[model samples]
Target: MAETGEGSRPGYSSAVELRGVGHGKREHAAASPPPPATDAAVLHSSVLDTIGEEITGDALPEGHVLTLEQIRERFGVSRTVARETMRILESMGLVRSRRRVGITVQPRASWNVYDPRVIWWRLSGPGRNAQLRSLTELRIAVEPLAAGAAARSASAAERERAVGIAATLRALGEAGDLDRFLEADIAFHTLLLQASGNEMFGALADVVAVVLQGRTQLGLMPHHPEPAALDLHEAVADAVAGGRPRDAETGMRELLAEVRHAMLPLWEPRTRKG
Candidate 1:
């Protein structure tokens, strides 16, 4: 995994900060409290997010052992906070805790990759390029199928909304309004997945949304999205509106193909000095 550097997102570079989101949603861990309600809760969230990112970013590599006392000292938190942080990480499979052996960082394979915080950490850190590639590939596989399904079964209102979002995407992309463009882009995918009428596909809406926002936050998105890609967004939406499953599927695949073309180089292996 690559370590975050100058081009990294805001909270990612700081090593200890909360990451707000682009999509009006707060991407906190499932185990976390709602909005860090209390002072102690804020402390716990801060500690958990910081240590979680360190482990995800490979700063704390596999087999790195840590003690509750060490965490308490390093983060200036109470032993209660330190213990809870490690306990959450252990439950997420990012670490293992033993009575006397201490908390040990586990390998990537041991991580609960589906956890949204893990996904956010990986995408925001040096592992960004890799996570984007993996997530994009997943989008390529799932979104097309979702588009086709939506074409077949989407409610009349959903079909109309898809068209409107697609129109918004094109306008924002052309006008260089990336912020609005990103929101519209999120709407485009979110609507398609939910409208797909498949529970499994609908469940992945967050995963897709995270990667979309991550791309922009990481500086991978261009000043303006390519015109061809914008056209395909419309194509998929129109296909869904027209009730053409095959067209929706094909259009989505072609759209994602352009995404892969634009993003592939970011994930290519590069020589790094230790």
Candidate 2:
């Protein structure tokens, strides 16, 4: 589901595992006392993301790499903060570091391109054209199959929820309420994935959320869902409700293709041109 990297780096995966566990605890502890609200941790992540945006915009190409010292100076954050930020970037496949090599910008193809966080970082500017393109590629691969599974497996209630989400998205799209549209989009996708009855599939909900956020920020997709797009989403839900797996798969494929087409115009020549 979530690809981290080569597994060569010590403690590379610990942070992600910790984050996932924290997320699960948050989800399950609905009635439990809240944890220390570390707004700064989130802010740290945001600042690191901004650093990524800068890298994407200017420093990454022609091998103008960065060091922890430089990063600390550039961001004016503590060495620990800068280190953690680079760890975040490394996890997203934006940077690679070794015991001695320090850090280097990995090529676009090397990125964990499907991670929503990475996608958001890319959508922050011109540097992420490759990242956006890779994200679409992952969508093309995973979504149609997920749709088919949903078609074959979704319960009646799940199907209804999917359809309702799509419909609401359509209305929001028509109103140009991009924020609401993205929310509905996430709900629609989460319903479909959850309907698959695969826990791993369900885990992608966060990734989907990130992708929607990134696309919205990039101004590629509408703030609101397009009516036609909404209709296609509905068609998929209907197929899933009817247990027509092939139909659902085809419907989802078409819908994703349409979105990709819409996004192609927004992508820069480096990413969009064949």
Candidate 3:
């Protein structure tokens, strides 16, 4: 199993299983608030929301660069907090500060689309059709290939497990049990990646988990998948288990195309706010 990188999505190399979409763990422990860090910092959600709205909400106003002092005063935080907040913003690719100039907003293109934090932030808005499309696109690009490779490489036991998981997912869907269905879905995909016998590809289990997490967060999976969707995974697993790489690839591709179509209805209304 690959050791997850510092910012890697969570569950990258573990088989313990994840409940929802996306990898990466967040610390949200509830503790009594301590004295403010002397350095300018704003730790409240209100401040983070304000900053996100400022950058992504509108076109930059004339000479819209924000000085550290300005952020501190605007949010009523110590300079240290403001500075730390700026660092956070920079990590999100929301702003850039040069030696001479203060923090200047970066174009949306600079944002880390793959970073779980940014994706979560974006999903907090009114709609998440774009995010959904992007995630599924990521799945389409990587999963089919993984399925083909799994067909060629999986150990006998791993192949059997993959087939079993696929059957379980189908049964869960048939029972209209979304919660268990999602669990089986995660396991089904994770098995495919693990069975591929390529560490780089196997590492993508986190990515798959993340995608499922995002969808579940947005209420997209429905109470049960369409029956056709339910059958898709089984077909892929069956092809792979039978050592039919080409068939596995074809089945996976078809499954992805169906997912893409299911997602189109959600992305139809544009949400690009300038």
> Which is the leading candidate under lDDT?
1
The weakest ten consecutive residues by lDDT in model 3 span: 24-33
**Candidate 3 local accuracy as lDDT?**
0.67
Please say which candidate is ahead in TM-score: 1 or 2.
Answer: 1
RMSD of each: 5.8, 8.1, 8.1
| Sort by TM-score, top down from the best | 1, 3, 2
**In order, how many clashes per candidate?**
0, 3, 17
* TM-score of candidate 2 against the unseen true structure: 0.66
What would the per-residue lDDT of candidate 1 be over residues 1-274, giving only the tens digit for each residue? 3444323222222211122221124433322223334333567777887888899886998999999999999999889889888988999999999988999999788899877678878876775777788889999999999999999999898898888888988888999999778767877887798889998887677787767766777777999888888989999999999999999999999988888877777777741223
Stretches of candidate 2 above 4 Å error?
Answer: 1-47, 62-65, 91-93, 98-101, 169-179, 199-230, 272-274
The residue pairs in collision within model 2 are: 173-224, 173-225, 178-223
Report the alpha-carbon TM-score of model 3 versus the true structure: 0.71
Ranked by lDDT, top first: 1, 3, 2
The local distance difference test score of model 2 is 0.65
